[model samples]
Target: MKAMTFKAFAVVNEIDLNKIAIHCGIPKKFTWEEPLILKGAILESILGREINAGQMVLIFSFGSVVFINQTEPSETTILLKFIQRFEPDVEINNADRYTDDYKLHIHENESLELADEYVMVPEFEEFYPELISTVLAKSVALEKTEEQLGKIHDRLETMIDRLEKGKLRIGNKELARTTAKILRHEYNTLAYIMILDKPEITWSSSTASEFYDKMMEFFELSDRYKILKSKTEILYNIMDGFSTISHSIRGLFVEWVIVLLILFEIVLTLLQIAGLLP
Candidate 1:
């Protein structure tokens, strides 16, 4: 028997899910309310040809459109090519699995474990799409954070150079302001990924929830999530340090100005008392 291959693709940054539902001719019975999950029928081409080797499930969410194919590698390529024709604007990222080498034992809860590399499920739901989208979103967010961090590092270096030259500069305040803006942007990005992009699965089905939790472990989604969270915290700490340094410098400059003004006043009074001026 040929092994089953599972392939998932994140086809877009955001999709008008209503448009997808109408385009796919989704049935009322197959739609979910909370997170707006829709499942389409087995997709066929214009010539009435099946899109993939076995079956294709079309899933749509707010920021992601996923096509799960149960097929071989060659057929998978054909399926992706067909999708790209209609979705020219999407940015695609994929996760793949091949289940040939392992002994498969079908469980009652619609999930089958094939060794350590692959897991098979009878149906695709909100969990699968959410998992795939979270992975892609985290990757994109991580890249953005790294890029911002590089800019922050460069600015810190420039500030250190000016200080070494004994120049009391206010540019650090501007740098702090810019860093605050970047920090807000990064915070929003991470928040959207963590909170808004969550999967809203109904808890009415214990089996479904169990399967999802198990699959999450199998995919190591928690590990990736933790890593991203840690990086965001580090970025926050650096920005906080910059803010502290900026305030400290500003305070010292103000104190020096006050001292210089007092000294000037004392000198003027001494000069007048000594009759050195008219």
Candidate 2:
């Protein structure tokens, strides 16, 4: 029997976990343990297949849903359609296929070279969704961060143009405030992806760790992680610059107020000396 695995992922903002469980028709007892991983048997009919071929649905709190099936890649189409039935507002969708071979003696990296071929293992099936989900979540996070950066760049460009023309007004300050808020939200999203949403190492299982490490390398996850880190740092620097500029503007306004007060006092003293004021 030729075993094959197909994985599909969808990026969403937030999925009500309980709602999804209920929507999938998972029994309340089975869901109480780990609501994230839903077995295929419970959804087989709804998914329109005998998931005994191997199926698992993993939902991440970071807003990613991964469906893994050990059947033909074509079979996944129905599953994907079924998921979309519940979640109509998916932001991004991606799919990957791998053929499983038991006879082939393939190293982890070599398996990647085959591209869509993988060595069959029970542990791999258990952990595969986490790997795929991590990658998908990271991709989504990067996309979101880049979008925020783009908006900040646009606003910054406008602010720079106004400043160059010596027409920086109260609106500029408001823009800076808005940008800061966006930056904060973006930073939080990045943190969630990098820290909270990452896949944890299964210390007890060295095989699982090796698989994760190899797969991460195969996916160039480290490189992507570095890029995300660099982008986050750039955003932090920009936010810092905004803060400095805001403080400088406030200082300038304070100085003008102080000078005006001083001039008013001098005028009042002169009027009193001239017997023109009480």
* Candidate 1 TM-score versus the reference: 0.56
lDDT of 1 by residue, 29-108 (tens): 32322223322333554214545443444343323333344434554455444445555555433423211121122345
Best by lDDT: 2
Writing each residue's lDDT as its tens digit, candidate 2 over 96-152 gives 321112121224433333233444443234555555545544454445555556676
- Candidate 2: give the clashing pairs: none
Question: TM-scores for all candidates?
Answer: 0.56, 0.66
Clashes of each: 0, 0
Off by over 4 Å in 2: 1-3, 22-35, 45-52, 70-151, 170-189, 195-201
- After aligning candidate 1 to the native by TM-score, how far in Å is the CA of 191 from where it should be? 2.7
Worst 10 residues of 1 by lDDT: 95-104
